[model samples]
Target: MTDRSAAGTTFDDFVAARSTALWRSAFLLTGDRHKAEDLLQVALVKTWRRWDRLTGGVEPAEAYVRRALVTTYTDWWRRRWRGEVPTGELPERPTTGRDGPGAVDVRRDVLTALAGLSRGQRAVLVLRYFDDLTEQQTADVLGVSRGTVKSQASRALAALRSSPALTDHDHPATEEEPS
Candidate 1:
């Protein structure tokens, strides 16, 4: 079956090329693999609905999809359901020794720190640092001013530094004696 959008490119082709990157961004934004998958799916569906209107090519289409993802996430944050009850019990861990200790620990700590951030702060950090977007680009993505992006990034970094899971108290002070 031929899979082609109105832009003369197949949706499958676009997904094949960019799905991994999109999924990574989604994971960073959502902080949970399952939520990330759902977020990506919803964004893609929204993008597909308006695929034909995405002129100028794949880049524009990707931009539209990213905007959809961010907007959808923001909407979800606003209407977050409070009906779900949290269980105090911790889930059983599988003893899989695949990743290196340092790498695994760092990844876990980073994700935990990210989870500690507010939605806007987390979005800014993910877009500016993890996605490697410029301040202006991040602002554009989140539909905010560059100044807002800068402030959010600053606050997010401060929060991360203060996170007990991410802080390194072992470092010695480097202050020099006054001359």
Candidate 2:
């Protein structure tokens, strides 16, 4: 087998290939665009520092970066500022465009519902459902047990089910199964 360290696979190449997916996961975790950018940057920096050890294809690098992202995000939650920072300009509402206001509202409502969850619960939901990671994968990313992942997912789902914002809407966060 050719040594990947001798082969191309630069950190830049890895970032170029997976930045969008990483950024989307960051956005899901942070629930804000700018924070997501910061999170992704931090994770990439961590990955770059360990790049020599992460020398496979993009998969290892991506996995390492994702773990960094979740760990950093969990750390941020501990000391996160409760007070809102004032900005000079109000952030513009996302244009509904052809999808219309309902689509935007649904997105907003779901985000709001997610925001209501505890950090662990939110992380589990994002990593499992949104990122489509398996139970073991999510547990590995968060450094928790598979049982913890399942329980957190159950609690997060139950919370979302009972969320007033989602409950009021015609479309629920999760589709109800037939009785």
Candidate 3:
């Protein structure tokens, strides 16, 4: 048999092998399918750019892609034209022409709670918990010190715990506002 791929792998084959896992990571990072697709596209572009540099194997390629995804997500939030997608578990609205006030309230609360976080804090939490990055990896991904990552993560969790969205489980209901 003759060898065809110089690196012994085709780009299309690589995409086929990794797209599912990559899509899952992207979803966790962006909290929305649309944003996830955008992130994945950016990651793929970066992967293509460095394909030769990633000749070590899939492990290196995967790491490169992950790093790209995380960095792209961080930059996206920092953009003036970008907005946070809703990060809650519910349908947007009811089909029966109902106000679905409770659903709307819940969604708003969740969105507000997440918004309470600094961009760095949110990225830290998502990278650490959602993406399951080690503290060191998260720090590297965010281009910050590990100490900064830990502090931001602590503050982010504390804010989530204190958010009125959480209080809804026991306290009186109230209208939510953006953070």
Number of the top TM-score candidate: 2
Q: With candidate 2 superimposed using the best TM-score fit, by how many Å does residue 113's alpha carbon deviate from the native?
A: 0.4
Sequence-dependent TM-score of model 3:
0.67
**lDDT digits (tens) for residues 1-179 of candidate 3:** 12222166766677888887888767655555687898999888878876766776676677778778878877877783265444444345442345354645654565567666776777787778767789998888777899999999878877887776668654323445347
Poorest 10 consecutive residues by lDDT, candidate 3? 1-10
lDDT of each: 0.76, 0.78, 0.70
Pairs that collide, model 1: none
Model 3: CA > 4 A from native: 1-9, 80-112, 167-179
Model 1, span 41-142: residue lDDT tens? 999999888877777778888878888888998888777722323222223244357644455455566677677787889899888887788998888889
Error of 1 at 55 (Å): 1.2
How well does candidate 1 match the true structure in TM-score terms?
Answer: 0.80
Q: Which regions in candidate 2 have their CA more than 4 angstroms from the true location?
A: 1-7, 82-92, 96-101, 168-179
Residue ranges of candidate 1 with Cα displaced over 4 Å: 81-103, 168-179
Give the per-residue lDDT digits (tens) of candidate 2, residues 119-157: 899899988997899999999988999999999998998
Ranking by lDDT: 2, 1, 3
- Model 2: lDDT equals 0.78
Report the error of model 3 at residue 109, Å.
Answer: 6.3
